[model samples]
Target: MGIDPTNPTGIKAFVFDVFGTVVDWRSGVAREAQPFLNRHAPDLDVSEFVDAWRREYSPAMEEVRSGRRPYVRLDVLHRENLVKVLAHFGIAGACEPEIDELNLAWHRLDPWPDAVDALHRLKRRFIIAPLSNGNIRLMVDIAKRGGLPWDAVLGAEVVRAYKPSPRVYSETAEILAIAPRELCLVAAHNNDLAAARRVGLSTAFVRRPTEHGPHQTSDLKADEAWDFVVDDLHELATQLGCAR
Candidate 1:
């Protein structure tokens, strides 16, 4: 039942986990946050500020995932978290428009250096899209700004659930009119791929050792024997038989 990395014959589409796998969210956010911080919180560390904002991401999603709150797009959750992070740092003078602009840091993420070209290569062979926790608009914005060529954006907002939610994987396959076995979930997070694997989707683990920062400890390597384990999107494209 193990997948063959070199020749994954049945996989018809490759869905990516965008945040860390395709785009460098941490660096991108920090870059966007710097000017804002310089204007407002001159004493704050840009990296710490970005990290704090991101730290709230999971819990915000968990509220919807646990059904304690109804489904809301990631944009809404991010704004709410941004307000909280600002308050946590004693930043209270930011106006709503300012907050809204800063919250869009997610939408302006820069892709990994190899991402765009590799995606173009992979797209030539298989359907390529994002199966991310980000909403459709957010995905579109990121793809547009990062120059990522996705066939479609499919994920949390589409499925009404987030990653590690079985429904996200199953429903994404349904949307593509393909069986779960014919879809491969490519991600930097081991947990995301593990969840996809549980739902019968093939998995590829792309290492993003500094996804959190230079000292990041989690997801530094694949936790399971994924169908494909590679150092970057280019490597995954190569293993998937994508042409240069």
Candidate 2:
């Protein structure tokens, strides 16, 4: 039902989800909290706080994505949730600057083991960019921090809509100067892939079972039949006939 990149098919571009697809935001954010917690709340068990902090991701995104709340960057959403989560844990002693630095942890997420090399291979073969719910600035910051080789960055800010919205996918294609069918949406989230399929964009699923850590309960594997289901981004490059 979708174009296959390795078949010498019509797809010429790949749009990726940045958060979990390319970078391990959960673990990365949690790791980034380690030093600060070690210095401040040495015995506070920041691991639980990290997990609890991530629990708010969906609900926060839904507010902006569903139109119940106005467009807000994920950074702001993370911070908004961070405040509540910190209070919920009764973790105190953080000042404005400290909170600001913690808020930026999302921008410095480490890419998966094979993500960089694979992205380079994919970039060599096609127009590769991020099409995510993250704002352009945040995406750019992450790319720079992670050294991601993206030809361009596309985000919900560009379309004023989020994933699962046809307009977002369509707009990404338009911005890349490619047709919907010529673009493939690569993500770790099934909902994201499903949205691309509905909008006429090919889909590739890169499994990220550990994205939510030990408590991850969903998205352990591809749910819907996707055009491709690679174990990691590097495998995706190889499957697409990319050399090395």
Candidate 3:
């Protein structure tokens, strides 16, 4: 059912997918990597390299989600993935200290221009927190760095499971002291919303087409009939009547 932008049913809180939804991870990562690549490996493509690093995100977490590996934070997984991608490009001579610095780029990512303002608007009507793959400290750090007004920081680390796992959604709702139906998951990724929907949460889809750069193909539009679909976070605030 298409939600009336004017009315948000029972929603008391909005749980967000932080990476691509609230911030432009692709550009943020590439911006950090390009300087190093230009200085050391000028022939390498920055955007392509950043996308390659991002593609490793899900699979790296699967090992932990499946219990094949013990629970670890996204920060650790990010570092591991960065190492692998660097090796894949065969960019030798880069040491662990330098690679680790690059991995921290995820922690310090800048928000989309509208992200902070939108969150401030939404916070007036709803308790806002990140339901991201990032760990609690990581999300909190990013929020502090970017001036995001999150009511709380919650994510995979809090639940000890990656997203798409029912526990992540259900536990987040549990923590917020709200019913799953009253907790809306706002994200740019369809798969994240699909999982949240399956777990009985309300959903809002906001597009971030340039999130993965020009070659991006996925999530150009909402695939499923989500409750709400808006062009930007601020638009979502207007749709939800949260604007002040």
Candidate 4:
């Protein structure tokens, strides 16, 4: 679909979910861990390692979501999760510096092949930024490295809360001084869009069929009546009449 030239839905901005949505975190992490895996545990499966690390993602964030842990950044959570996964694989005690370097892999993930072009077209019409769990620095780094062209960086750290929490969605709208209905949360994850919708933000579901690396069973299609559902951001732009 071509870009749309109208703003029929009244969406003033598009806030994105970065991981697995805008950027392909699963493959990116696997790619980053390949060399290290070859050197440390040559026989280990790279995808399994990445999946294990990601599997810990929600529970770690749940600690914060439930207020059991204070609002620590996602970077800290990711690093901690990485350490645990590495140790579980018997690759522990690998130099602290190297492990830390591996943790930074999240910051260097490549954008999806369509992400840059789609975002460019979408940006021409609406304000675009990452409303992600990634901390400000992480989001900023990804934007810089990937040329994502986000108008602002806002997310978990800024709100001091995680998504699926009403605060994260509501506070983002508050920060932008836009009504919840005026801002759209665009994501490849269903749970994320559902959360955003519950808090009154308009939602858009985009397809990222390979986001979880083929075995991905969820979010293959929209489960809710989202305001916009498209195959890609370019299609989203087209639907919103923001096509270029």
Better of 2 and 4 by lDDT: 4
Q: What TM-score against the true fold does each predicted structure earn? A: 0.96, 0.92, 0.94, 0.96
lDDT per residue as tens, model 2, 1-244: 6655456757799989988889988788878898878877787776787888888988887887788998877778889998998788677888989989988888888888898888899888799999988888889988888889999888788888877778999888898888898899999999888888988999999889888777788899899889899899878888888888
TM-score of model 3 vs. true structure: 0.94
- Writing each residue's lDDT as its tens digit, candidate 4 over 1-244 gives 3434455577788899999889999888899999889889999999999999999999999999998999999999999999999889999657988899999989989998888988989888789999999999999999999999999999999989998799999999999999999899999999999889988999989999998888889899999888888898788877766567
lDDT scores for all predictions? Answer: 0.92, 0.85, 0.90, 0.90
Q: Model 1 reaches what TM-score against the true structure?
A: 0.96
Per-residue lDDT tens digits of candidate 1, residues 160-216?
888889999999999999999899999999999989999899999999898999999
Cα lDDT tens digits, model 3, 10-114, are 788999999999988888888899887987689999988988999899999999888899999999999889888888998888877888888888888899999
Model 3: which ten-residue window has the lowest total lDDT? 1-10
| Sequence-dependent TM-score of model 2 | 0.92
TM-score-best of 1 and 3: 1
What order do you get sorting by lDDT, best first? 1, 4, 3, 2
In model 3, the clashing pairs are none
- Top-lDDT candidate index: 1
Please provide the root mean square deviation of candidate 2 (C-alpha atoms, Å).
2.6
Error of 2 at 39 (Å): 4.5
lDDT over C-alpha atoms for residue 65 of model 2: 71
Misplaced by over 4 Å in model 2 are 1-7
